[model samples]
Target: MASPAGTTARHGDICVGLMSGTSADAIDAAVVGITGAGATARLELLGFGTMPLPPEVRRELFLVFDQAERAVERLCSLNVVLGELFADAARTACRQAGVPLAQVFVIGSHGQTVWHQPERDSTVPISTPSTLQIGEPAVIAERTGVPVMANFRAADIAAGGQGAPLVPYFDWVTLRHPERSRAVQNIGGIANVTYLPAGGDIEDVRAFDTGPGNALIDGVVTLLTGGTATFDADGRLAAQGSIDEGLLARLLADPYLNRPPPKTTGRERYGLPLCRRLLEETGLPEGALADPAAPFSLRQRALDLVATVTAFTARSIAEVYRRWLPPIDEVIVSGGGSRNPALLSMLRAALDPVPVVTLEAYGIDSKAKEAMAFALPAHDGLLGLPTNVPGTTGARRQVILGTLTPPTGIVPRSQGKEGQV
Candidate 1:
């Protein structure tokens, strides 16, 4: 294993960034090159890849994650399974990139988040304002033979922060420009934005969850289609259904949409139960809603749900910009939500004259953006630099995020495998 270098060292390094967002779809692994230090941080994207969870695994994981009460043994068992899966994804990315596992310096895995309760107190079952991201770093390291840096959010929460919107640090590094104020909006299972002012200091950055990215849409689609569909692909269903204006208004009335910055939420608040409640309140359904049910024709209802969720996400982001930041020059979007034409159309409509661009326009793949974000923090961890932005995570003070898992042994390399070819 490689040992941590002294603070003054400045050597080129390669780090693998792994992330499984709120959607719980797959693990995104990105290889990034880090150079320079401190205020002069520089990043280069070497390669990237995504390994999806099997449909059954995804369903089981989501069930355990969304349910309030789950068997402790099952949760613990899944943690190890997830770790192995994460390692497999990382190794697969390495093979595709033609990079040797031994050559890579660090692996930064965001892990799979089962639950995030940042509002908890002493009396709560889980102590403190805690968050849980399984997939042990030790398993990743053992499988890949590389030092792994996991659990990036715990330190931030410990410092009185929300432990989310951590991507803003990377957004600041990758998108901050002297000429324009740019907003890097990621529409994942939940939508969030990182606002970088034109020529702004670190303190000027703003980030927060914009609510319900693909979460609600996916929920409705699954419920309506009887698990035959995971989502409303390309907004086809939504395009076929008319927006139920009354339900849309009711759905948008949730207090989360109106909350200020530095907030975070997940399936705990916006999952199937909430969707069912919304339907009931609108006098739409009774009894258990089954997929592929006749008479009610959930297809149209599902479409309406997708359209409304997309619209809500876009409108909330636009509202945030209008309220907190300066005139937005461009909105750079990324993640699975970006692929949804209906969502993008709604976003453009909501933002009006502001114009939206995908992260691809700036040379960052939308699916890999969050993984790359972890790379930035991992780089900071290795360098002893503060990774959290006080303005974004609500941390009392700036702190370097993540732990360093140094390489265990130096493996002698063959002639053809040594160094970057």
Candidate 2:
């Protein structure tokens, strides 16, 4: 059931955070016990787990990502479909933590983003800056009987912000250092970095999308395997092959890489379409990619392509640091890309002398960082606090981020439940 307006969570209340990144690989859920609010907020991870998206659901999500081309009905049905899946994720996290559903104070869901156009189209007169992340909060609330906080981006966009890199709020609250400048780098389907100046306040934070992360590499792998494989698998293929310097150089030339901060990009720019173009440019025939028994020469070419894309992802991040970010004492890496050794090796080479480490070194799960971040914002929103950081997101002013959907208090006897880079 909905709490009275303005009523907030008591100290040590359990909260759940749900996230489905651009990879759309799985729903990451974290059940956390939160105390305090805003910068003083403290979060204790009770339990965390991931539930992979079903193949069919992932297929539909890609179609929708095609944007303005898919049928309206598909988008409509997917909204509720994702909501149910999200609810399941929340419940799973609680169960894993041995916490009852009734004990949860709220659920914060960063719903799957199908489209994000934070700026208006120059070619289309009617286009406006808008964003959409669709896993209906009402459905989540009804299913779990817990108040839900969602749509964390729209408010900032409406305030003339990029409405992205919102995780910096989390970075600021929990990861800031007193004596060391740090770049909290996350490499999901897209790579982004948050620079925290040593001992600086929230206004000193800086962040932006660097370029393609695992998306291009994952796209190529999926295409070459004819959907049998979706990623480079710890970058084994990339490690075996060689980088195509020409393709890598061409990818580095992307304007988005040079675009100023407060900018973001998604599948619309780096998705499967770019994967096909890169393959065509490399002269790899479609027939060879779909064949398991391809000639040794063609197989080598596939590996080379993966290596090149991984290099591109790493170089893009290093390039951004050189061009925009201040000198950093260290870089704390997180997200799916951190698992790729080849990608990490390339990143280390690109930024020599800068210590690069993972969140795990600091006693946090890299995969769970983003999901846990949202738990704080949900906690703040319930306390009627603003969570957006103007310096990072370019918002006109500080603004509270989510729209609250009060719980329906329904516990069903049975339920049926069911992204791209």
In order, what is each prediction's RMSD in angstroms?
5.0, 5.8
| Candidate 2 wrong stretches, greater than 4 Å | 1-11, 67-70, 287-290, 408-421
Q: What lDDT is reached at residue 36 by model 2? A: 69
**Over the stretch 1-421, how does candidate 2's per-residue lDDT look in tens digits?**
3323332243265789999999888999998887666788787888999999999999888887765465477899999999999999999898988877877777899999988887899998799988889889999998888888899999999888988989999998889999999999999998999999999899899888888989999998988788878998988979988998987888899999888888888888999889989889887865455686788999899889989999999999999999999899999999999999999999999889998998899888998898998887886776778889888888999889898887654321101100000
Q: How many backbone clashes does candidate 2 have?
A: 0
Over 1-421, each residue of candidate 1 has an lDDT whose tens digit, in order, gives 3324431133356678999988788899998766664457787777899888988778778768766366566678778989899999889887888677866767888999888886766666657677888887888989998877778888899899989878888888778999899888998888888889999888999888877888878776666566667777998877676677776776667788777778888888877777666656644442223434545565456556656666766676777677666678999999898998888888898888988988889877887788878877876675567888879878898887876554474422212223210
Candidate with best lDDT: 2
Model 1 CA lDDT for position 281: 60
Worst 10 residues of 1 by lDDT: 412-421
Worst 10 residues of 2 by lDDT: 412-421
Per-candidate Cα lDDT values, in order, are 0.77, 0.86
